[model samples]
Target: MKNAISIAMMALFSLCCAAQNISVQSINYPTRYLRHSDSKGYLGEMLSDLDRQDASFKLVNAGIPDCPNCIRFESVNYPGQYLRHSNYLIWLSALSSDLDYKDASFRLVQGLAGTDRVQRTTHADVFR
Candidate 1:
């Protein structure tokens, strides 16, 4: 009887500990990790997994990027000497130019496929 009582108390202690989840986050930013694909061949292949059973379907939301801010690329007066293309990262802080194009293409092709996965957007829908 004592052994069974001890086991039950141990199980109860574990359950209480599990209930107290430790959240070690200071801040949360709205960010997404879209698959980046440079090849046209991969575009068609990305859609094959978006069946009805899959809950994590493709999605696209058009808004200002979280990084590289709202500054237009052409407007920036980039000094090509000390801050050469190699040293650009240290100068302007964060530059996500490659991610802007590469990830977008993957997300777009996902939209084009019109699966049970993608939330469809038409030209009309974009205007509103």
Candidate 2:
């Protein structure tokens, strides 16, 4: 009985951890979600809103030694590239060596609405 309880507890813990994956949703457009709508996953891809599945993303730790608050948005479907912003638009791109695209890094904070949360860009310091 004790062994069974331990196994059940461990399984519960793993499920709780996996449930923590975060997503970036539009505050202005509540029905729309941030995602890639382009055929080619290249730079300057169509960063638009969608009503369905591809919109969800995982908020990953940027892994920067100095920046603890910084985070990278990794797609639930495409794990390699991260959600990047350029020209006031958001798209996915791979983590390059120089890391010049730190604009992609954002801090999740209390949004305009009291209970809601927002992904504020670290570079421009604007809510998305």
Candidate 3:
């Protein structure tokens, strides 16, 4: 009975962790997914196994102090790197400063086109 209870608890914890892992896909181009290469973010097709890994990200709580409701996308492959917008362009970078935290933080809202999808809005209001 003890072993069975432990196994069930472990399985529940695994499911919760897995729920936070995701791949951002483009609505217009469903076959393309958001990926990072050369520290730049791009919507590209998953042509190889590495591409799939590059596209995967863990949805984590915002790194900023004030925004507990916001979220950040941490690259699964790169570990410490997160998706951040700079100069109107998105890039995968290692966050260090308050500015970096703000840049990386985003809110997930209902898609403008439809409710079936989600849209990411940046704290700077620069990217949608």
Q: What are the lDDT figures for the candidates, one per model?
A: 0.23, 0.54, 0.77
lDDT of 3 at 19: 57
Identify the candidate with maximal TM-score.
3
Model 3 clashing residue pairs (backbone): none
Question: How do all the candidates rank in terms of TM-score, highest first?
Answer: 3, 2, 1
Name the lDDT value of residue 39 in candidate 3: 98
What lDDT would candidate 1 get against the real structure? 0.23
Ranked by lDDT from best down, the candidates are: 3, 2, 1
Per-residue lDDT over 1-128 for candidate 2, one digit per residue giving the tens place of the 0 to 100 score: 34443453343334333645544456666654555656222222224434233565666666565555566666667677777766666667776754435767765444455433433656443322
Candidate 1, residues 88-119: lDDT per residue as tens digits? 12111123564433223211112222331222
Q: Which stretches of candidate 2 lie over 4 Å from their true place?
A: 1-20, 39-51, 124-128
- TM-score for all models, in order of appearance: 0.15, 0.61, 0.78
| Deviation from native of the Cα of residue 63 in model 3, angstroms | 5.4
Q: Candidate 3 at residue 115, lDDT?
A: 44
Give the candidate number with the greatest lDDT: 3
Off by over 4 Å in 1: 1-56, 65-128
What are the clash counts of all predictions, listed in order? 0, 0, 0
